[model samples]
Target: MTALPPVVDEQTWRDALADLLVREKAATKELDAIAAARRRLPAVKLPEYRLTAEDGSSVTLAEVFDGRSQLVIYHHMWSDGNRWQCSGCTGLTSQWTRTGALAELDARFVVVTNGPMDEILAYKKRVGNEMTWYSSAGSAFGADMDAGPGEGFAFNVFLRDGDDVYRTWHTTSRGAEQFSLFFAISDVLPYGRQEVWQDVPDGWPQDPTYERWLTSKDVAALYGDPEA
Candidate 1:
């Protein structure tokens, strides 16, 4: 355990908050500019990629667009011979279980993983996810698109134009955290994710020692696998 922040007078806290507002406003504007730039980034034409669904149905990358112009594929982390799922990937799915914006924005969002089709389906069922998921194993989709080596999480953006699919953008590792709201909320917590690496204030409650205590398997054990 670590000591909590000290209680200060209201006026003193107000002054500190007012000072922080300047930085917050600047960050907001900078982020807005970055998004604008991201929207303008050029896209690359994709190949004739084929992926399989949990039901063993064959689907093309363009088909994944599902008639939507914009498509977002969440490349979940799973691998062959690995029994446990990626904790970060699991965290992302757990937080972002559903979204109404897919239809509103003329977009379809799906999850993809290289894990065995059966294992992916079992994990999906265990997690109680309604989102459509696909297996990109033995497919160029994962290898060519930088989804990482079987156990890496990534958010890949795609665009569809009259039956042709194009790769717009993709982010992996810590950058993929943008797809998860848990990180944003965690940023507001006093401990701030409780990870060993964060440079939080001294004496803050956190796990300074790195360990595997927080992971997808932990989540599964705590929440109970729905399939089981």
Candidate 2:
């Protein structure tokens, strides 16, 4: 091959890199605007529903917030019987950080699910996440939000002004993308970036392809002792 051209001067290289950084910042701003527009869309009204808590206490949707106008509900994908926990949910939950900023915005975040109170508590404790979690066992709230079993992952936001409650936003695809913030901030090495098809250094192991972890069990397993 012909000899390569002379290397560019440091100042020239820095100028070109600066220009690219400006463009990247502008692109990020545009993406943020798009996300803001999505959040501004109107929300459907949700009927008031009651759900049980992990403490064996009962709470209404509004009560979960401790008297706040907004709520961010994470439908944790936990199941009973042979289905002890959801890998995808576990993956997302493991990435959550309890930022006091959430409360400053007049909103509270919670993970609601049909899993038993004891099981949910055990998992939360094991994971070491401080985000509030609740059990929606025997409640229609989960079904109403399309977050029950057989339903895909969902992140939903609700706002209440007085007694009126409306769903402000909901997302299901690549919803766990925010988990990358940890790596972007250099807090932790990226783990599942492979899910985005991004290139990795040669010889690195690829991320697992399974959507959720499955427990070893047959169809008859559901009717037997659930905790066994």
Candidate 3:
């Protein structure tokens, strides 16, 4: 077994926790300040772009909001005609099983990919993904947003003002971690992700970063998809 944290008297443990709590509260306040600054950031109006819906129907970017004032589009990574999707993107997508609560906040969450609609739908079924997905095929929607075919993934936020749409924020890489409750929960565990990059006790287990990311096969097992 790996080494465990040293045992201490109850009062000593309580004192250690009190010290950590002080830092945790300060960090929380800093995060709140950051969010306040983010809200004050200016947004840019975007040009018109058409996207293909699940029914093969064409729709405008503004219509993606679905009558909501705010929209959050996860720019899913996809390889044209490839059945093996990006494991990282697939795992992150799987974590978003329930999004109905976001609607109460006047925000609609959906996914857009550069893959062809037909192939995307087929893959979605094979993986049992429930999130509403659209295809940017035959349009500049993906490229203009820096998430074209095979260009990686991103989370793009927008605001709708009647027929006009404004780009509010765009984040990729680790920024997308906000959507992953799995990561949030892992962070509180004793091993704390167990990744080589993280600081841990010398005897603790550690592996290369992302070495254990979930794959389509993992999702298939969870969802009971025979096709995977």
Candidate 4:
């Protein structure tokens, strides 16, 4: 067990907390400035590409906007043959099962993978997600973005102007970690993700991040909910 902080009078504890609060406030302002700069970054015009829908229909880049003007595409990591998408990517996309409000905000979210249409539909049905799914099979869309399906998972943002589409921004690797709220919640716990990669006090349980799936079953176990 970790040792508790030393007992101190109220005034001293308040002083120590105020000192940390100053640094926290400064960090918040810096993050706000960074976000402002990100908004101003220039967008590039994307090359022509077509994606396949679950029904085997072709969906163009402009059509993906779906009259919303803004589109957010998730380049899901996928595998061939009997394999499925990367477990991490599957969990990441499953988090977006409910995105109806995005349409109201004039933003659309879609999933694009290199997997075949049938494979994509099968997995979607298994998980019961409603987000639009598309296949980039035999399309330059994946290669142009440099994250071809199974190679890596990425999030891409696009903007539509008249009949043209522009690549506004993109993020991958650890930069895209913010999309998964599960990581955000785990960050606040005492054990702090319980990952060996994190620096924690001695005796804290540690395991590789790959082992922590944090599935629906895990949630049901915690809350003892029979319906989950």
Tens-digit per-residue lDDT, 112-192, candidate 1: 887668888777766655678898888877878777464467788999998788888888867876676877888777777
* lDDT for each residue of candidate 4 in 93-181, tens digit (9 for 90 to 100): 76776787898879899988888888777666555556798889999798677678457888899989867899988899988877888
Model 2 weakest lDDT span, ten residues long: 211-220
Cα lDDT over the full model 2: 0.67
User: CA RMSD for every model?
Assistant: 2.2, 7.4, 1.1, 3.9
Stretches of candidate 4 exceeding 4 Å from the true structure: 1-20, 214-228
96-166, model 2: which lDDT tens digit per residue? 66555887889888888877787777656555546678887788777778788657667888998776788
lDDT values, one for every candidate: 0.78, 0.67, 0.89, 0.78
Poorly placed runs, candidate 2 (over 4 Å): 1-16, 82-84, 183-196, 199-228
Off by over 4 Å in 1: 209-213, 221-227
TM-score of 1: 0.90
Q: Assess every candidate by TM-score.
A: 0.90, 0.74, 0.97, 0.84
Clashing pairs in 2: none
Which of the two, 1 or 4, has more TM-score? 1
How many residue pairs collide in each prediction? 0, 0, 0, 0
Q: Pick the candidate with the highest lDDT.
A: 3
